[model samples]
Target: MILTADVLENAFVRLEPFEPSMRAEVRSALDCDPDSWGGMVAAAYGPHFDGWWTAAMAAMCAGSRIPWAVRRQSDGAVIGTTSLYEIRPEHRRCEVGSTFYRPETRGGPVNPACKRLLLDHAFAAGAVRVEIITDTLNPASQAAIRKLGARDEGVLARHKITWTGRIRDTAQFAILDLDWPKVRQLLDDRIAGFSES
Candidate 1:
């Protein structure tokens, strides 16, 4: 169920699946920007992520509904991670979240290019709707989703008190396949505008 045709190419980045050899690189990338989500993720899974990324990567490699991976390029350095989770075949919907990128990759073509790859893949996989949810406080991520043309569905107030004991507000966004032609065109324009030298 390789939801996507394969890796997507753009002027600055490529979104592809996590591979076995990427273990160390992924660990390295996740290690940076510790103040962001380091304690939440890396410390919990760092030592054995080689197997974890491998398993997760294998699932995506198997074309499972939740195919996911750490983002990188020909350089094989992991800069971010995202996944198509909570898939509902009957509903023709799935979520695109659990995404994080190193600070270095921010405000670069990397983020948009990665999103373009995911969105195209989801729509191309016959999904009627692809959604993304971001913590309300994470303005950067929220803005990025909006820039991609996703409509604000709603806010899940106090969605779930995290283990850290913080009540999180989630801002949801979605792009239906019906909007792909236009959204894709919009992304193309944005990517072009940003990549211009």
Candidate 2:
């Protein structure tokens, strides 16, 4: 499917096109949890965010990724960013990663809602496979991926070094198009339950 920096929204959160104008709000919101990126590649503070934003925009410009500023729907506050990257239309596959949320928004409804939107869009775009990978050391993320109904595809040893110079073992997970029906139902049920609570 054709991917663009289109605004994507569900009941709980809104994914707006990432723009330079959104820097301050996003940075401010991310400041709510300064160490949020500890498990990931980018830093959330100081000039590091600028570097991350630049690379993100570059990927968008090159049509390799579509990034969004994740905003809480209830209050329209920027919460974090998520993207569909490594888009391979011919292969009908893409990766969902580079996601970060404000600390307070973690362990809540935001992530499930966002993933629902991204997965829905990816499959609609003719994706046969959608991947979600995390550092092997991150149990929280591993659990989240499992909850998405993605089958464990094992790990890639010495995947990539983080910004902190830590060698990471990447835990790979994926949901195939054939599995979408069941996985979508699970995510839908989770979002509904989350919305209720």
Candidate 3:
């Protein structure tokens, strides 16, 4: 079973469970600047968003995924989406992926803040491992994951079929239950830095 989609929030961001009401807000955020999703799966932006949303909704209803709409606290606008997919309750693992943000918020506190909340929730939900993977071509994504203190687990060649119909290699990273202490501190420091600036 997937973890419950409880509201997760911090000073910078709030992750709310996805629902039909968020469609317009999320669509508007993603449609603002197409470039923000350049390295991500093509469907995440542009004309394919509708199809992607449909599939995601189906997954949520199937109990295999929990989706969240990331929102900024200052204005309470949806900025992007993220999810816990491939959830395996028996194995106590899940993938904290399918994440994206608006271009202006890319290098700010939102990502780390969201990650901290998600990680905390996952571990607290009895997850022993939380995996995050990115397209191999996305160095920025790889770097961000590293900063979260997750260890690299190498690449998976031809792991996914992108929206553009290309076979893509994926870079895998993971954080085990044992690594949470240090990782949590790393995240706390990062969030503090954001608040300072």
Candidate 4:
């Protein structure tokens, strides 16, 4: 199974391959909240934005990660970004992480729509496990992952040093291939409910 980036979309959001031209727009969207970067391992706003952008592009070019610009389908506006990284085809696993969106896009169908597309793509490409890891300090992120039907796999203590030099505990979650059917249904139902409202 060769895992590669492809355009993934649903009714609410579209995940397009991240490109150099999108750097400015994506950075502007991310700059809306400096506090949003607090729980993130790497800074993505202000002075740190350039470094983050460079590394992301390098990873994509090196085939180590597949990043996407998250666009709202209604306006074709780039609201944020996400990625499938730490991919290991031999192990049939990959991580859905590095996800962030503008403040307005949170707590709506945008997230579930994006995850549904990413999960569906990974599973279809023969992935046995898809993991979503987050900073333990960020309960909002952990809760959002749980809402997607991911099983909490506990914390990884001293997981990694954050950009601010803080040792972060990572909250791990996973949805195995065996669990996909139920998770898929849950996500679909949730997105459908959003549309209904």
- The C-alpha RMSD of each candidate to the native structure, in angstroms, is 3.4, 1.3, 1.5, 0.9
Which lDDT tens digits does candidate 1 get at residues 1-197? 23553656555666555555655666666655545653222221445445546666666656553433445554766676667765767787888765767887788777777778788877877899988887787787788899889989989888856435677787889999999899999888877887684
Indicate the worst ten consecutive residues by lDDT in candidate 4. 29-38
lDDT of each: 0.69, 0.88, 0.87, 0.91
Rank ordering of all candidates by TM-score, starting from the highest: 4, 2, 3, 1
**Could you give candidate 2's per-residue lDDT for residues 92-196 as a string of tens digits?**
899999888877788999999999999998998889999999999889999999998999999999988888988889999999999999999999999999878
Candidates 1 and 3 compared: the better one by lDDT is 3
> Where in model 2 is the C-alpha error above 4 Å?
none
Regions more than 4 Å wrong, model 4: none
TM-score of each: 0.80, 0.95, 0.95, 0.97
Better of 1 and 2 by TM-score: 2
Clashing pairs in 2: 1-125
Per-residue CA lDDT of model 4 for 11-97, tens digit only, reads 999898888788888898778788888878898988988999899889988877898989999999999999999888889999998
Give the higher-TM-score candidate: 2 or 3.
Answer: 2
Candidate 4 lDDT at 126 equals 95
lDDT of 3 by residue, 164-185 (tens): 6778899999999999999999
TM-score of 1: 0.80
Candidate ordering by lDDT (highest first): 4, 2, 3, 1
Q: Is candidate 1 or candidate 4 better by lDDT?
A: 4
User: What ranges in model 1 sit over 4 Å off?
Assistant: 1-5, 38-76, 161-163
User: Model 3: how far is 24 from its true place, Å?
Assistant: 0.6
